[model samples]
Target: MRAGHLLLSRSSLSHLLLIFTLLSTFTAASFVRSRAPSPQRTAGAASRRDLISDTVENILHPVIHFAPTVLGISINNKGLQLDNGTNPNDPVQVSQALQTQPPPIDLGQLLQDITPNYNTSKTLDSACSAIHTALPNNDYVGRVCTTPECIQSTTHYYNARQAGNRPACVTYPTSSQDVVTIMKLLREYDVTYAIKAVGHSTGYNFTTALGFSSTTGILIDMSKMKAVSYDASTGIARWEPGQSWGELATTMAQYGAQVVGGRLGAVGPGLSFGGGISWYSGQVGFASDTTHAFEIVLADGTFIIATQDNQYSDLWWAAKVGMNSFGIITAVHSRTLPGTTTYGGSVIFPTDKMLDVLGAYANWINGGADKCKKGFVLPAITDFFVESLITRLNIFEFFFDGTDPGECFKDFNIINTLYDDRKVQPYPDFLNKALTNQQFVFSGFNNALYSSVTDLINKDQLLAIYNAWEEYSVQTSGAYLQNTLSFSVITKTGLAASQANGGNAMGVSGGDGYLWVCYAEGSIPAIGALMDTKLFGLTPQAAQAVPKSQRKLPLYANYARLEQKPFLTYGGIELLRQIKKKYDPDNFISSHTTGHDFY
Candidate 1:
């Protein structure tokens, strides 16, 4: 502890001082908006803004009490006050905020957090023991399965390559309170952990992993909290983080309604928060747009609700695509719509017409995309590749909430096909068919490179992406198994749908770009993982071909490779960092959790 600076060995005093200044001054909205002003101040005007509010008084009150540690403080009639003569409860004075080249801090003392370096087993034991004793009844699901096969099974993800990294323990919470208890213990112990909601995430350390020093020590599987309830009057549906789209779709069908959810049945909330792309996305926008409320647990174990109209509205917009930075969401409440039946199915084209299909697919999204009736309700569409031991086929999965096979979809009729199963069926049945054989038989370690691009490139560019995938598929034909490169448009209509719901972390706007989904599938023991990354055309040289303005953020977090930091691609990564600090002051999240290092 030092009197004139924040002296801690972990970081420099100046940097720490600067950080504290930003954390105590800037609002969460400042960092995330695409056109937001920079934090740097000019000498002329001392414009100021308040970052804290009475709602979060409990969090910042201690900071005020400890102001003397870095900014200096003194006792006064109103209580503990800053030495700078500012009101402790008044809005922070930005005019007195830190400058670009901040001077040495003058304080009476320093406060430091517990170091992240600790014995992994001891911390894990402590966390698990506390959770076990606290939730001793049917609500808790905590275990340390020693069997190799069982440990191996828990690691299985949509992509099989991510299956081998197991953590020391797995704990499932039955309710938000359980999450609050578990988070408190883990944060207290400074334990690194991963979160798994059905293991659909392909990114490493996202769900669970083993090395404590390297990122994984504990895995918090959110499976036991599967509860879904719908209110007919309000037309709102609430679901636990663990529930899958398949389960929700089927259940909501009984109520003659449906929530904007995953296209493939197995996807859970992680994708929803990461700008969830769906078969219904064209009209409904991202499934995440449907999210109206989130019951979340902050790093400090404080359970709070983040919504558009609340005091935490900034956090609400940030959480839209900020992933786990804001908190661990326990329940997501979204409005449901009437009419769940849809007409469409898979149409398989011969391998000879691959080029034709790719070209036509490009045309469908580029020129004919406007055929969307309401501009928002798009004819559900997906074209992908299915490859197995001896078979390779191109399939187009289509659907629409309406009865007719709309003209917007008639473009597919141009190509000769083998099996065409387009028909009118319930939404649940449509997604059930999406749970195809490939997911079961040949699924393993895989990576998806998704992005929002300026527009659909030429057939040649699209072919290049596919050709690269094909080459990799041929090379690692045995290890990774199958891969497909597909594209989905985020048309003007879809963009509005998302914007109407408080927007999200994705900086994309209508007319800005098309969402590209490039995925590679294979069995365990990945031979194509590296090549899977290369197929995206996200490399520096590849991105250079596009105009600077059109160079969109690379891969979606859910579909990104292990090394990718999708949060940085967001326009508000800095705002997300400030929000992280406000909620996770002790740096517990960066030390103990995986995915997107906000700072």
Candidate 2:
């Protein structure tokens, strides 16, 4: 009985200790809670707790929970009252009692991120109704086939913006008046918009459609506005925006005329703003250099004409490389060359003499030996099958205006025959047989990284650079090295025509530089993965292969990657910023906020 009494006493002491611990915890919690407001008051305590819970919820589910302006919010359970520590009147806050709240999301920022696509069925229905009401009798106004089979007839390319998760829509403008109507609607809705011409741009800012992903915003399809013509007397041609280089080429060929345009035929004018290097660039200059005039539709739904001698010269300069940020170009007037029905083409070389062959060509180009100014000379090195397979290096060349092939061929033969292993075939038969099967050679625009050099490096320097490039090419999949190693005389024809009327942002500010173009060609597989170093599975990955000194931080506008340094590369970001302010102060007109667009 005495032992049992002692056990019972010990149990009572243990229970007392447990109660004491619970009381201490509750007292400490209450003291801390009381410091925020009158936490002793049950209503105040509940309100502070509610504020903390709401703050967390807002962060997690902002779209459904909060209004548009909220940027971000963080809640500190330590102090519940509008902690006077940060800015007050932040609308994102849950209560005046809380110390801090989320900052509001910028309206401009939201517009930049959001790209939405309208349901094709819904947009078609909307288009049909609008077209009928506007122009009842005109068959062309709403002429899209309305049959069940023709349901998804409109071309849609709104994928990238949708992936980034933005509001996007599409409007079909059947006429110039319809374009004005859409402009009015954009103003009324107070939303950002962009125009689409052939949907060719790969960059986030220029293109709206993603082939397999969700679309971001309203696409302004200008396919219906295709118009082209040429005047032989004045050597002038007018082209609408939506036409492809191939289409324009064929059309102009009928008029016995040719254009100095992009190298590939399929490239469109949408983001090939200003102009770009083309196959004919060797002779005439760049595509934009030949542009005589432009008809631009401004932000205010007004049309303005810019020509060689014009009141809106600044617009003309901006139009060359300004992209779609300023306005939509309805038509371009460009200088056209007298058509040549016959042209010279051939491949020159022998595999064993690659070093000598390349060196000879380089010397000729550098020394102006053959007077081959603005002439296209593309070289390719590939495997040749003989008794044993060996490397074959050769050049594919063409002279557009029917220059006598004898002199050029003699020059080529002089170096080639020295090695006693060279052969030459006529231009006509060679191109037909060699290039016949490779029809899709110019189908897509590959990512091309380039650098320019005016200070001619020595043969040793050239050999060193080539060795480094060849090593890089072998290491990386699908990388290629090609060069346009010519002189300034070739590009001197147009005489910096655009410079007289302001100047193109992309036009050569510093003239005469050697252009080295390195490109990666293949199907789009794992672009993001390729960029990330971790995926490469190496101690030093692809990024390390390209040194800071080797890399030209600036990029050529036409072939540049969207993620590449825009301001430093493009050389017009600040100028564009000031222009954006003057033309679009409210920032309602949004492109994908490129590095150039940011500053």
Candidate 3:
């Protein structure tokens, strides 16, 4: 994490800048955190102060001194190198360093191993050949990886799929026209393909292989299609598929226009098309709720504009959380408003207050009057338990239009007061780097388990879940309960709009506010069963009286395991099937039928 620097006081800001410069002038703590052996997982494995101190001493300090003399490179606390002067030899040195460490995993090698033999099927062969012919000669899509690597590398799916298998080939679509062309290829070849934007699926559900399709068939990558156009006079934005929430925020900020997007900007626009939720979602509506129109490429290789006024409005409803069962979404036109400069940052709270903290969070989401208008949506989250000693409560707090820190102080103080030991830092600085700089055991993929309780916002339920999480993690050692809490006045919009297309299983009707409590943690084999059993497979049950109908479906695509029937959970099982038949009768996109079938 970047030093706890904010645009707060002059001294603090200056110290932050000085520290930033000093750290930059040196090149010591490589983003590698060294992990000590753990006996069993435990909460007291590493204290926050200890971790912070070690990060400064081991990583930051060395890079600070060694940088100018040996490497002649200046790196910021976040490890972004600043070039004082150009050195052609620097490329060779940097290349050697990267080669020594390499990225965590190789995407091509993993694909070749996990992919079925090249002789798998005619459909796969035909689809792969077509994809290979489509790519322009570029290192990004070199001769080795036909289509899969292009998607995997750019989308960072290799990072996500390490917990599972990687796709063999990835296909790039230059535009909505290209998307339709690829769909026709899939239909003619009778091959299955995965339609992905952002590729930030959370769990095993969305990314997992559902049908009998080989890896080489198709991995439809839309990263290149990221284009954003806005008409300030029209108060609307036409956003292309592969765009991320961060890109949207930065882009819109330039025009002083804002759309409801999430803190994790890298998690593409595909997420919003599937029922977008954001910190601002509570007041404005889920990201999808703000969507006015969608330019879609359906299974029949036909491109159509679908909206409330469009001819295919039924298909529009099903697209909310239908996964890829429908077709590819090329662009989304969403209502936009003036952007705000004033924003809130990520907050850290003491570990002892997890239950009370989350309970208070549940209460706040249910009753934080006028906060959403100012863009205050706090998604409570817990980050890595870096050695069983420290797990930071990472909260994504937002403010929409208000710039006065004084205006946001009440909310900030309320949350900070929850714990005597709290650290407040700007959101941008916090997310610009990894959690620790030690030789930490970095997992190939980070998985987040999430469930939303909308109608029944019970304090006891929140507390019970927290207590259960603590008890569970205490035994497991490596795992901890992380949460992201969002409550919105737009609950009615989500409920009404979810059924507008074809409806979904994300039971979010008549909810006062939405509470999405998620548990996100990462670990290596040294932690063993603690990472798998306690972290991976524990079902959280807080209130037995509450039915499952009140919960919003899980948000990120990868977080939902295949059996979760995510399409149904987000809206409804039956509606998903109907939309599947209507838009993609051939099921070109994945239809995860482990147990829950769309139709």
TM-score of each: 0.71, 0.59, 0.68
Pick the lDDT winner: 1
| lDDT measured at residue 217 in model 2 versus the true structure, 0 to 100 | 31
Residues 242-286 of candidate 1: C-alpha lDDT, one tens digit per residue:
867888889889889998877677666787877787766766677
- Error of model 1, residue 158, in angstroms: 2.7
Candidate 3 has its poorest 10 consecutive residues by lDDT at 432-441
At residue 195, give the lDDT of candidate 3: 59
Instruction: State each model's CA lDDT, in order.
Output: 0.55, 0.41, 0.47
Candidates ranked by TM-score: 1, 3, 2
* Winner of 1 and 2 under TM-score: 1
Model 2 lowest lDDT segment of ten: 383-392
Write candidate 2's Cα lDDT for 1-599 as tens digits. Answer: 32234336555554543333233223222222333221111110122222123444434442322221132322111211234443222211211211122221111112122212332344434543453355443332222223321112123221122223222333445556666666555554444444666544434433433321113233455656678888878999888877666667767777877765654445567534645665455555556767788887667766777875888766666667766666667888888777444344434344345566556555544433224443544443321111111112233444444444345434455554211211233222223323211222321212122223223333444444444433332232111111111112223332243344345665354343334333322211112223112112221232233344543433454443444434355555566567667766666555322223444
Stretches > 4 Å off in candidate 2: 1-175, 191-194, 205-215, 342-353, 364-370, 379-397, 403-465, 478-503, 507-511, 531-554, 570-577, 591-598
Off by over 4 Å in 1: 1-120, 138-153, 205-216, 373-390, 435-454, 526-549
The deviation in Å at residue 38 for candidate 2 is: 80
